[model samples]
Target: MPKPPRTRAAALTATALLLSALLAGCGDDGSGDEDLTAQELSWKDCPAPSQAQGGGGSPSPLPDDGTWQCATMKAPRDWDDPKGDTIGIELIRVKSSGDESRRIGSLIFNFGGPGGSGVTTLPAFGDGYEKLRTRYDLVSFDPRGVGRSEPVLCANDQRLDAYFQQDSTPDDGAERTELVDSTKEFNAACEKNSEEMLPHVSTTDAARDMDLMRQVLGDDKLHYFGISYGTELGGVYAHLFPGNVGRAVFDAVVDPTQNAEQGALGQARGFQRALDNFAADCTSKVEDCPIGDTAQDVKDRIAKLLKDLDSKPIEGIFPRQLTQSAATNGIAQALYSKEFWPYLTQGLEEAYDGTGRTLMLLSDSMNGRSENGEYSNIAAANISINCADDKPRYTPEYVERKLPEFRSASNVFGDFLAWSMLSCTDWAVAGAADHPDVGAAGSAPILVVGNTGDPATPYEGARRMVQALGKGVGVELTYRGQGHGAYDSKNKCVQDAVNGYLLDGKVPTAGTVCS
Candidate 1:
């Protein structure tokens, strides 16, 4: 999840938010193109403000931002059978800030949630990327199963609201059974609602749509920036179309090689490390701390609080009660950036006071819940895409067996993460394609960034990506900061390195550490 610009600055002003050597034959040459029928995009003003900005049922317009124009691009539902059915991919493009004659090219962006909306995000934080926008027309799209595209809506608002609050940590056999049952119900709902679309909404499908965008835009090669889960999509694209890969940067990188279980294990440990860092920082200023004076004290108190909420929820300023799942999500959301740490402090303080408004809102933002109780299709889309890309869903018995390992990885958030991965156990996959090793061998040197303290996509994932991309194809840049994303934070070294790469095509030397 991305921190909106306002809160991002606040967190990073308090904190700070990498890469290595040039490999031979890694530079981009004027690329070749296979002649294909290219579609054209007709730009128009976005929909009304209420429909666009408000979490309404209809499609969102371009957030009333004057500079952005919205368009819908047509893509084959199943690439292998292109003529069978087609779907629309929502796109928002902000033209270059400089003169059109001087414009370099379009830079595509994806902001991480397998379900995250580039339509909403670009408007929320576009200005911060003045360097890129000034030179290239910044383009972002809602992939096949997200946002204003042909979305995947599982449950309605009321049902989803209740589901979001379900207890994440099951304490007994009955609780575990309930958890498994709930997972089945949710997956069944998604299948019933979006059976035709689920099979084609994986990262590979999205990458094909991205290539369509490139063809329409008349770009000879692809220039892209992807964060967190988006990096997974970009990596897939790079491997599929190495010759089309241009200046691509995968920040807060995800390792494409890991299966669902391995990915979850890494994330469990990563989040635990982040919580420890947050606890250590929080204890230093005990007066503002909500739990205790030391990291272990904070950990124990939080674990107890979650356990307490599983049985008895706290009614906060909102009409809904805060449950263990929502509270865990709330805490995890704030862990994305240090600037949000104070907000986490404030939220936990309120939760301790028996009012959970702040924490609830935090969780709501992470899930894209609106003030009026409307929901984005993100939750459904996130599960669908993850399940589709990483096949082999775990059975109840498998999950129970792995429970101990997960708890050992993260006593606080591990069980929740582990059980949640089982949502696709019963969901059908139509000819699901196996993910291959993605090195993009013939592509230009791709920038792979790692944040030493990032929780969601751990730092080691970046190293793994570098290795996957082979010796020369990957450039490693390290940020000694705390956050899920590195480029948009307050670190001048990181900002300079990224800006320099995007603007001048200057690749940082290997092992470049930005402190």
Candidate 2:
């Protein structure tokens, strides 16, 4: 559910445009391997993003007429063997606008997805961070096995279209077998296409790369901004290089304590809570709720629509039909942000009339499919990194057994998330651990922001992260709001707290609340 838990927190941002117009070798041993860190980056004007990075024109110039710079930094293919082959980590940045004398080194960002290409993302949302840019260069990069960083390719566009279309929530034995076979085939394709990369794309390896990136950037401490899954990455980085951390923020925080199953379960509940909130909001409006007479009625109609779509799909974008799985995906995507709620209302209204175009567009956004039908490696990288980081692998039977529990969590999302546990079935690489180790015992204070209505990472994760980051390290800030993250909501209160912490050295009082 929520596109595999650590799925792109920016999906709602992408979906809105569709509605309108659409490792290892590289760990901190304290020795700081001089060779890799010593190499200089050759920054130049950013070129158009590659297909793997979600193809688009080059980043537009900043308000001050400064262009976004792009570069590739070499990192170990495997952190366990730092001297072995190297892979390029694609990076993008815009230098500070404030006085050079007041500049505070580079402020790096990783905006979730684990698969998201920060090179493209940073510039797309660059204007929002202009204030921070006044004191620091806003920089972001594609981790190894993602985007232009020697990306982990699996099926091609046509194959992916078919792959995503297949039913993920199976009912009978025959359907279950088909789902398993399809999942295995997808995993096999990834291994065949990226055997070498599959083993090294774990979170730990990426953490090491960040440490190397900090050294190469000439920053004595790594100043960072992490959102959603990026928060997990930030935690791992802090754990690895406690002494090297500068000011860091973790928003829409992921619980470092949960294993894959627990994480999925948490998302099922979170999405369900968000759905309930959506229903209540719609019904409370002055005008009649277009979708239902009451909040419960709205949810019931959705459940009925899904059940009907399972057997008889509806006409979607020209050649495709909207199947139950795709509709569910689209709904999940819409639930990510409250701004997209109106779109969800309209999509549901249209779906009730036997048309499915809008919902399909949202599904396409979730899968990283563009208007041109080309796909970024988002889904591929998500599965690859998740399978490598998580140790447990589930069989169809296990999912079947867990269905009731999942269903009880959320009538709309339960079975879907329960079935997702099989994504790592027959994965080529052995997983690294049961759960990530994020105990940064001696690290500098890291601001952890959580939104109460966040469907993906959930708000409770903020508290878990605070505890896991160890006492005095994670300063918890709560935003009683909707959507996946707090900072991007542009709520002045949340932004003020975060900006105060990052722009200055003023960490908000621990347990600060922003509404």
Output the number of the lDDT-best candidate. Answer: 2
User: Model 2, range 316-354, lDDT digits (tens) per residue?
Assistant: 987889999999988988888898898889899999999
lDDT for 80 in candidate 2 is: 84
For all candidates in order, the CA lDDT equals: 0.74, 0.87
Candidate 1 segments exceeding 4 Å error? 1-36, 48-66, 286-290, 430-436
Candidate 2 runs further than 4 Å off? 5-9, 22-34
Query: What shift in Å separates residue 344 of candidate 1 from its native position after superposition?
Result: 0.8
- RMSD values for the candidates in order, in angstroms, are 7.9, 3.6
Worst 10 residues of 1 by lDDT: 17-26
Candidate number of the best TM-score:
2
Clashing pairs in 1: 11-339, 18-477, 18-478, 19-476, 19-477, 20-476, 20-509, 20-510, 20-511, 21-510
- Across 412-461, the per-residue lDDT of candidate 1 in tens digits comes to 87887788667677777742544435777888989898999988888998
Q: lDDT score of model 1?
A: 0.74
